[model samples]
Target chain A: MALLEVTNLSITFGGLRAVDNFNLTMEKGELYGLIGPNGAGKTTVFNLLTGVYKADEGLIKLDGLDITGHRTAEIDRDGIARTFQNIRLFKDLPVIDNVKVGLHNQFNYSTAESMLHCGRYHKVEKEMDEEAMKLLGVFDLDKERDYLSANLPYGKQRKLEIARAMATKPKLLLLDEPAAGMNPNETAELMETIQLIRDKFDMTILLIEHDMKLVSGICEKLTVLNFGRILAHGDTKDVLANPEVIKAYIGE
Target chain B: MRKTQKKTLITYAIVIIAYIILEIFMKAGMMSSHLKGLLVPMVYYAIAAVALNLCVGILGELSLGHAGFMCVGAFSSAIVSQLLSGAIPDALRFILALIIGVVISALFGMLIGIPVLRLNGDYLAIVTLAFGEIIKNILNSIYLGVDSAGVHLSLKSQMALGLADDGKVLINGAMGITGTPQDSNFTIAIVVLLISLFIVQNMIDSRDGRAIMSIRDNRIASESVGINITKYKMTGFVVSAAIAGAAGVLFSHNIATMQATSQYFGYNVSIMILVYVVLGGIGNIRGSVIAACILYLLPELLRGLNKYRMLIYSIVLIVMMIINWSPALRDKRDKLRKKLMKGAGHGAA
Candidate 1:
């Protein structure tokens, strides 16, 4: 059975159908890519899936359990995590704290225990610190763990956000425009990091990218969306070769 | 130690050392009686300011109904203490009063937080402001009395309770609660302040604190990370309210008669607490305590200045704001701190 299945997911705002009858099915550990021109509603689909926006009509299921319209935090607890296009880190906090926030649910200490620094609080906090440090190490951010996230350079900030998401231990990870603002070298590094995270963590990934090179290098399957609907989807090369995909990208 | 943990330790040490020094000076007759009288109030207000900071600074929510929660604590605990007077030891009675005040105020916090926390920014502030006014007005007109039969309550006055001649009027409408045991002292106030600091500081360093701060930093990001926003928001708000309530109990016991007037539990008082938090530096627990103590005592200390007292106070406030928030000064302070830390080999090595 697929790890995630979305059927007839549709939403409209005012008169515009932001997403229309979007359907997706993903087996465990698949690396998928979502591509679209600007305003093609790719992010809207992600928003709907993550429960930032409710779909007007549809069903979203993970591990065969219906999860449509669940709260964003609930969806995350159910093993789904995502990175934002704008890179939202707790700017004033240290990089490790940002990752520790992603590990929020894994700690079993009660508020009273934490406030008194007793029992589970000490044990769980030590464990979380170790875990957060490990995740930061994976992204080459362990050295910068004590620095405030806002002080980091752009590429590291982006990588830190993904590392933070990984701390949630999600079964499926979503990346919205992960390569939107990167130099060629940084993009190449991100591509390797993304591949490494997927393999080492053994988690499925669905990414939205404008960088075709990054998409082609890492994505196993591709889905092209245009005006809130899927235009073509299949093997990466075939979808990229479709005449419809070309016109959508070039604005015919 | 981590940088933040070390900072927290230094803050606590500074507060405790300063308090001890002041106490020593007072014992040596180096301080005036007016200054001595201000000590207990200074500690209580400092505690309240810390509580307010948890909401305004840490949780990143502007709450103006803090005075309302304080009032709830002040009245309920005052009544309990009055009822238990002569039957229990003063120390035990005072402790129970503080606990009762905390419980009552925390309940009010949760009750108010449920609907108000749903609104964000200005709307939340407005609702809390309205709640503060509502609580103040309700306390003004209400009359409460205890008799052999049981408790009696009325809105008009003592006569409305229609009690027996032996009955005691606990709350006399607009006159507020009277004859409550004055068990508050400098030592008790200081102990309360320390407890408040312990709770607020430990909370800020804890996992729950991280969740609260993350929500404040970015709601969408925090939610996406699987944090229950309502639960964490309530945690901060209720804990803050409980602390404020404890402070209120201390306050009521220090004064001869406790009144729930606008001057006491009004919008301005809420704003004053916010001012303390803001002037001290938001999310800085140590700053809140210092700001509260200095600001609360400044007027009394400057009483000899007569007409210029408020003027000097206002100028101090403005200067504090500039010092705390001015970008240039902040940058300089950060640089100085980094330099000192590096000089001490505190940086990553």
Candidate 2:
């Protein structure tokens, strides 16, 4: 069974069809890329799959469980996690707390236990802190763990967002424009981080990017979206050479 | 101790010591009668402000109906104490009243929160403001009575209750509940305030508190990380309402008669509580308590200033706003904090 399956996903906002008849199937551990021009419904597809928006019509199955129209948090708990196009770290929170939030579901202690600092609360918190520290270390954020996330440099903020999302232990991770505002050097580093995360965690990744160089270097398979529909999709090199994909990127 | 733990310990010690010193002065007749009378009320308001801070500051949801929850607690506990008077010792009766108030208020919080929390920002503020007004109006016309036959409630007036001579009237329309046992004092208020502080502070440091704060900081990110938005929001709201209810119990029992007036439990009161939270520093539990105490006592302290009392109070508020929110001040404060942490690190080494 595919790690993720979406069939005929359609959504319209007002008069605009933000996404229409979108379909995707990903094998476990596959690294896929989704690319489209401005306002071509790339992020909309991510939103639909993550349950931030209910598709007007379609089916989404993850691990063979039909998960279309579930709550956003429920979709996440079902093993899908996503980062935003714009960095959305918990800005005022310490970097460690930002990652610990992703571990919220793993704690088994009751609210009462936590309030009184009894039993599982202490044990679970210690474990969570250790795990969070390890995650930060993987992202090269160990030294800045005590600083507020907003105080981090722009590149580090983007990295921290990914680190936080990964802390949820997702089976399928989605990145939306993770390299949007980075310099060329930062983008190269982020590309490396993305590949490393996939290899280290053994997780499937679906990325949306406008940076052709980063996508070309890392994405094995590519899906091109235009006007809320798939223009072409297949192996990255062949799909990028398609005439329709060329026109969609350049002009009419 | 960890830095945060040490700060928390010092805050508690300072509060306790101040309370002790104030009590000593009051007992020695060194404090004025008016100042002494303000103590219990100040503590009650401080507790309420702390409760509201959990909702407004930490949860990042503006709730203007806190006064309505406070009213639910106040009236419910007052009625219970009246009904159970003479049957139970005052101490046990007061404790039971407080528990009952907390439970009922929490239920109301859940009831109102489920639908109301669906809205955010200004819409939420408007809805809660309306809820507070509705609660105040309802309390004005409510008539409650207890007798050997059981309890009776009427919305029209006390005449509608039609209680027998042996029966007792608990709430008499706008006249409100009367003859409540004045069991609350400054010491009890202080203890309750401390408990409020403890619960709020502990909750902020807990796993659940992290989830709550995350929701406030970034709702979409929080959801993406699998934090159930509704469940956590309700948890914070209900706990906030319960604490407000406890404060209400303290308030209702501190006086012989309690009226359901806008001045006490209405839109204005809710806004006033929000002001305390904002002026204190959002999400700072200790700041909320100190702000509540100082702001509550300020008016009484300036009462001798006559007509200039309100004018001076407004100037103080404006000055506090500048100090608390100015960007320049914030930068300086942050720099100072960094220096302090560095100094502490050197000392430890």
Candidate 3:
């Protein structure tokens, strides 16, 4: 069975269909790319998948569990984690603390224990610190772990966000425009980090991007979307070469 | 030790050392009675300020109803101490009263938090403001007494209570509760303040504290990451209210009369606590302690200056705000610190 399966996912805003009859299936450990022109319902699809918005109609299944119309937190607990396009982070917190917040459910202690710093509180906190540092080390953020997240350089901030997402231990990860504002060098580094995340954490990733270099460099399967409909779907090389997909990118 | 732990330890040490110095002064008769009388009140207000900071600074919610929670604690503990007054030993009765006060306040926190926490920003603040006023009004009109016929309550005149001759009036409408045991002292107040600081500081360094702060930072991202928003918000708010209630207990026991008055539990008092949280530097627990102490004591200390007292107070408020917040000033201060440190390093070399 596939790690994620969606059938006929649809949503409408007023008279316009934001996402219409969108269907997707992904196997475990796949590096999938979702590409489209601006406002082709790509982020809307992400919102629906993560339960930010209830789908007008659809069946969303992850690891064979039907998770349609669940709340965002519930869907995350069911194993889909994502990064935002605008890079939402706990800016006042230290870098490692941001990831520890992501690991909230994994290590549990009662409110009383937390307030008093007794019982399992110390043990769990130490474990969380070690684990968060380990994840930060992967992104090369361990040294800057004590710095408030807002103070990090832009490229490092993006990496920290991805690190925070990985702390949740999700089965499938979603990256929304991972290289939205990066220089070529940073974009190249992000591409390597995306691949490293997949290889090291055994993560399955689906990312949306406008940067063709990063997209073509890493994505194995490609799906081109335009006007909320699939323009082309196939292996990366074949889909990129399709005249229909090319037309959608640079109109006829 | 971690940086946060070291900072927390320093806060504790400061409070303890101050307590010892004050005790020595009081015992040696070096402090005036008028000045000494303000001690417990000062500490309790500091405790309330700490609680408000947790709600406003850490949870990132603006609340103007904390005085209502404090009112709840004060009235409830007063009634308990009045009823239990001769039935138990003084110390034990006070402890029980404090416990009951805290529990009841926490329950009220949970109840009020359910509806108030749903609103955001100004709406939340407005609703809480209304809540504080409502609690004060309700408590003002209530007349409660205990007798062999169990407890008697009346919103009408105290006479409408129709208590038996032996019945003791716990609360007499607007007159409020009087003759309650005075069980609070400076030592107890300082102890409670330190404990409140410890709890809030520890919680901030824990997973739950991180969750609360994450919600404050980005609600949607926290939700996307599987953090339960309502649960965490409620947790921070209720704990904050509970701590305020503890402060209330200290307040009621420190005075001879416990009245639900606008002077004590009104919107202005709530705003005053917020000022402490803001002026102390939001999200800075130790700052709350120091701010509450200095700001609360300042007016009284300047009593000899009478007319100019408030003027100086307002000027100090403005100065503290700039020192804590103005970015240009902060940059300059940071540079000055670096320069001083560099000189010290050269001297050591």
Candidate 4:
């Protein structure tokens, strides 16, 4: 059985069919990729999956449980996490604190316990601080953990977004155009980082990327979307070499 | 151990010293009783402003109907205290009164939060404003008096039931809620303010608080992280309402009297609460309280200009806002932070 099963999910934005009959299913530990031209509704599918908008029609299942219309955070607690297409770190807060925000559900202490700094409070707080720092170190951001998130350079900000998502301890992670503005070397580094994160965490991943080279290299399976429809889906090599996908992209 | 530590200690010391001086002035004949009466309102208003800050500033919800919850607390506790004053032990009655007040306010807080919490930004504001008006209208219709064989149907009407005379309005219509035990004052006000501060501060710093902030900062990003944005936002709204309700208890008793709900519940009070948060810098709790006191107290000192006091106050406020919120001043402030920080380490290492 797949880790996530999405079928017939659709959304319309005022006569624009942003997502129509979108479907995806991925096995545990699989690294999958989504590719499309601009305005192909790649991000819209992601938005639907994350529950940012209610789907006009669809059935979504995670581990055999119906999760359609569930709120995003509830979906996250059900073991899916995603980095945004645009980096959305809590700008004014320190880096480690950003990761700590993801650890919201894990703490057992009450508000009273935290304020009083009582026995359980100190223990839980120390563990969270340590955990947040560990995630930061994984992204080579331990030294920069005290700086405000917005002060960090762009590449570091992207890394912090991934690190913050990892703090949620998800079983499946989604990356929305993780390589959008990166130069060649930074793109290569991010590809390597994503692989390391998946292996270390033993998590499944579904990512949307515009860079065919990076997506083809890392993903085992690939799905090509165009105009709210799946152009192709198969092993990455098979889908990448498809005549339809190339025609849709090259417009020849 | 560090400069921030030393500075914080000194700031606290100065505030305590100032408080001591104010107490002495009160003891001396220099300050009139009327002026001294302002103390409770000052403290209570500050509490309400800060509580509003938690909703509007930290949670980023525009809640206009705080006075509705405040009314529930004020009237509920007033009735309880008045009813039990003669029958219960003096010390117990006071404690019971406060507890009942807080509980009533919290219940209303939860109740109102359920509906209004779903509305966003301006919609939420409009709904809450309507809710406040509804509460005021309801309070006007409550007939607390009954006439017959010395039995009253309800607490508000029991006074009428107890009255053995003709033509006396017991808890009269729109005359105002009278006979509230005037037990709340400066000492209790201060204690409640500190408690409110401590609560709001910890909440914003906690994981749930961060969740609320995350939604405010980025709704889509927050949802993708698997946060129930609605739950978190509603939690913030309800907790903030509870604080407002508690402040209402403080406001109700300190006045020791009220004529109409309109006297306290109005559009200006909401704006005043918002003003405190904005002037102090939106997310800074301590700064907000300081701003509340400055805005509230500063006008009173200019007594000779009483006729145009509000006008002058408005002018000063407008000028201050242009200076403080002016992007030019903010840019300079950022530069100043970078300069000062270059001289020292960021935190306790």
Candidate 1: which stretches are off by over 4 Å? B338-349
Q: Please give, for residues A1-252, the per-residue lDDT of candidate 4 as tens digits.
A: 988999999889999998889999999999999999999999888778777789999999988889899888788888878898888988877787788888877766765664444557768877988988888888999999779899998888999999888888888888999998999999999998999998888879999999988998899999999999999999998887889999999988
> Model 1: clashing residue pairs?
none
Candidate 2 lDDT tens digits, B1-349:
5556676777788789989999899889999887888999888888999999999888998888889888999999998999899999999999999999999999988988898776655566677688778888888988889878888899887888888889999999899999999999998898988888877887887898999999899998898999988888989999999999999999899888789999899788998898888998888888888888888889889999999999999998888888789999988988998999899999999
List, residue by residue over A1-252, the lDDT tens digit for candidate 1: 999999999999999998999999999999999999999899999999999999999999999999998999999999889999999999888899999999998877899986777778778888999999989889999999989999999999999999988999999999999988899999999999998998799989999999999999989999999999999999899999899999988857
Per model, kept true contacts as a fraction are 0.74, 0.78, 0.83, 0.47
- Please compute the TM-score of chain B alone for each predicted structure, in the order given: 0.95, 0.94, 0.95, 0.83
Q: Considering the two chains of model 4, state its CAPRI-style docking category.
A: medium
Order of quality (TM-score):
3, 1, 2, 4
For candidate 2, write residues A1-252 as lDDT tens digits.
899999999999999999989999999999999998889999999999999888999999999999998999999999999999988989889999999999888767898875667778778888998999999999999999889999999999999999999988899999999999999999999998998998899989999999999999999999999999999999999999999999989977
Over the stretch B236-327, how does candidate 3's per-residue lDDT look in tens digits? 98999989999999989988877899899999999999999899999999989899999999999999999999999999999999998999
In model 3, the runs with Cα more than 4 Å from the true position are B119-121, B334-349
Docking class of 2: high
- Model 1 CA lDDT for position B271: 90
Alpha-carbon runs more than 4 Å astray in model 2: B156-160, B334-349
Report the Cα lDDT for residue A235, model 2. Answer: 97
Error of 2 at B237 (Å): 0.9
- What clash pairs does model 4 have? A73-B226, A73-B227, B144-B156, B144-B157, B145-B157, B176-B259
Q: Lowest-scoring 10 consecutive residues by lDDT in candidate 1 chain A?
A: A114-123
CA lDDT for candidate 4: 0.77
